[model samples]
Target: MTTTRDKLEMVLARLAARAEDERVFMGLYPEAARAAADAADDRRLAGVSLGPLDGMLVSIKDLFDVAGEVTTAGSIVLRDAPPAAKDAAIVSRLRQAGAVILGKTGMVEFAFSGLGLNPNYGTPGNAVDPARIPGGSSSGAGVSVAEGTSEIAIGSDTGGSVRIPAAFNGVVGFKPTARRVPLDGAFPLAPSLDSIGPLARNVQHCALADAVMAGEEPHILDPYPLAGLRIGVPRGRLFAETEGMVEIAFEKTLGLLGRTGARIVDHDIDDLLRAMREATLHASIAAIEAAEIHADWLTTRAEDIDPRVHHWLVRSSAVPAHIYLRMMRRRRSLIEAMDRRLAVVDVLALPTTAITAPLMAPLEADEVLYNDADRLILRNTQMANQFDLTSVSLPLPHCERPVGLMLVARHGSDRRLLEIAAGIEALLAS
Candidate 1:
């Protein structure tokens, strides 16, 4: 039997072999991990098992607070912040479940950008191709899982932070309904929309980690039967501007599902999306809320913040309070409308991202390209947050580059979504 210590040593060796500049992790907890691994191994020797996650190698995003360490949230500005007195709620739960936390993974500064570029800590490259961007703000989480350094990686999904990187890196990422998992110690980008989730090599692992973090009893996911499954594809605007490769992969996956007796139909919510776009024309809820969170920093430490993030926050700060409130009120009604529309379908499916990971050089050197890519990359995934839904991104097979087929369901349907994803995952693999 492979001992937990054996797995820990292997992961440590792989991380050590990487160049220092690769920057998949912001920090590593080798000593603590080793101790945890030893404990797990001893328990196994005594014929005791904690659960499915026991002894699993997991990585956490930098935004999650670890006791006695500063939660940087991928920015240099927060380096001087006081150390956390206690672990984030999820961290504590993961430990209780016997997960050996390898380290804190890298993310976009303050979890702001979807392109995953962090000027402070270096961005980890795509797991498949080193030259391509790793989607963010859960950039490192996706890469860690894909590269085999971590079995499961925890990330915050405010606007596709978890799913985007998973899509780009060819891994599974699940974003539960907001507030499903406690966010007590996580540094927030947008508290209202922020959700704690996991990225892993498969749907089962993602489901396991999500359950542990949510303080639920982890159970084997009973895959939903594909036959007679109703899958609604919102194929109007969300499907627009998709790269040819992504579109092909998405359609191919849908075709497979259809052949398997899953019902595929066009479920148009373009009007709702358009309304959301118009409501947030001045600024998104995330941006406005983030601006409020960093208002002091924008005024005092403006020079220290990422220029791209700072610019958006600054713009968001300019929106009148009345407009922000009005937008929030309108958003609630839209959320209700979305829920009513979704009542007829089991889940809504779409391409996880509009395009695959773009090459890093152009995005780094060109501001226009960076902003455009960021917007496009975040377009599809952000809708889940806006409309209050549970979503997951499953990597589409046989693509030259990684692409994901995303499934979005009504809010608080996380378990059902996972079961559906598991069924789809099995179908795709078969």
Candidate 2:
């Protein structure tokens, strides 16, 4: 068996090669990681391995608190914030499961946007295509995994942060139901919408990390048979702006699933999109909640925050109390409607995003360009967040550019969703 130290040394060398590259890690803990790996090796020698993750290396998003380190959440504004007295709940879980914490990876400031652009820390180039974006706000987390810096990278998803990067980098990202894993020390983007998950090279990797993070025993995942499975394809604007490569790959995936005895059913989800769109116009839940979280910081350190992010907070702060409440009420009503619609299908399959990763140059040069791309990138993935559902983004190998085939399941169906995701993953590989 390969020793943990050997694997960890490889990871450290990788990080060192990119040491000056601020986009990947906000912090590195080689000393601690080496110590942890030594312990893991000792345990293995004694034949007392903790579990599947024992001796494995994983990276944490900067948004998560690592005991004795400040949680920057991708902004320099919090550089002086008090060091966390304890690890984030998930961090604690990962430690208990024997994962050597590699370091805290970069992110979009406060986990706000789908495009991982950070003015404070340079944006991490996409592992698949550096010229293009690696989706955010879990930008570095995905790259860390895609580049083999870590076996898995832990990240939070409010609106596609984890999934977008995973999709762009040609890896797997799983966003479980918001409540399945605790989010105690993760810096909030949108509290209600923020959910922690993992990005890895495959579905099984994500599943295993998820099990550990959920503080549950690592259990074997039996393949979920695709035969007779009811997969719903939402019919309407969800696919409107899909780029050619993404469209081709998604269609091909559907065809493959159909061949595997899966039933493809079209469900009209016009109302679902309509409701989410309306919510966007009048009540931005992310903005509202984010505004509250940063009220004090915005008042004092407005200049320190990213201008684009600050602008969002300004609008969020302006939301009238009534409008926010109305949006919340509408969200509940829409969730009920979505549950009824989804009951007919085992999983809702669609393109993770309408377009694959766009060039970062044009986006940076033009705010209008950035705005348009951001909206489109978040469009489909936001649906999962809005409805409080569990979702996974599986990479499409045949696409010219990386594209994610997103599978969404009803709220609280995380296990079922992951099982279906694993089955689809196995089918795709075959």
Best by TM-score: 1
In candidate 1, which residue pairs get closer than 3 Å at backbone N, Cα or C atoms, i.e. clash?
none
Error of 1 at 67 (Å): 0.6
Model 2 lDDT vs. the true structure? Answer: 0.89
- Each model's TM-score? 0.99, 0.98
The lDDT of each candidate is: 0.94, 0.89
lDDT of 2 by residue, 1-430 (tens): 7898999998888778767765788889999999999999999999898898898899999999988988889888899999999999999999989999979899999888999999898999999889989889999998889888989999999988889999999999999998789988888888889999999998888988998888777876777899999999986888887898988898889999999899998988987788777876854788899998899888789889998889889877988888888888888888899989899899999999999899999999999889899989998998899999999999988777888999999988888888899899999888
Give the best candidate by lDDT.
1
Task: Compose the digit string of candidate 1's lDDT tens values, residues 93-121.
Answer: 99999999989999999999999999878
Off by over 4 Å in 2: none
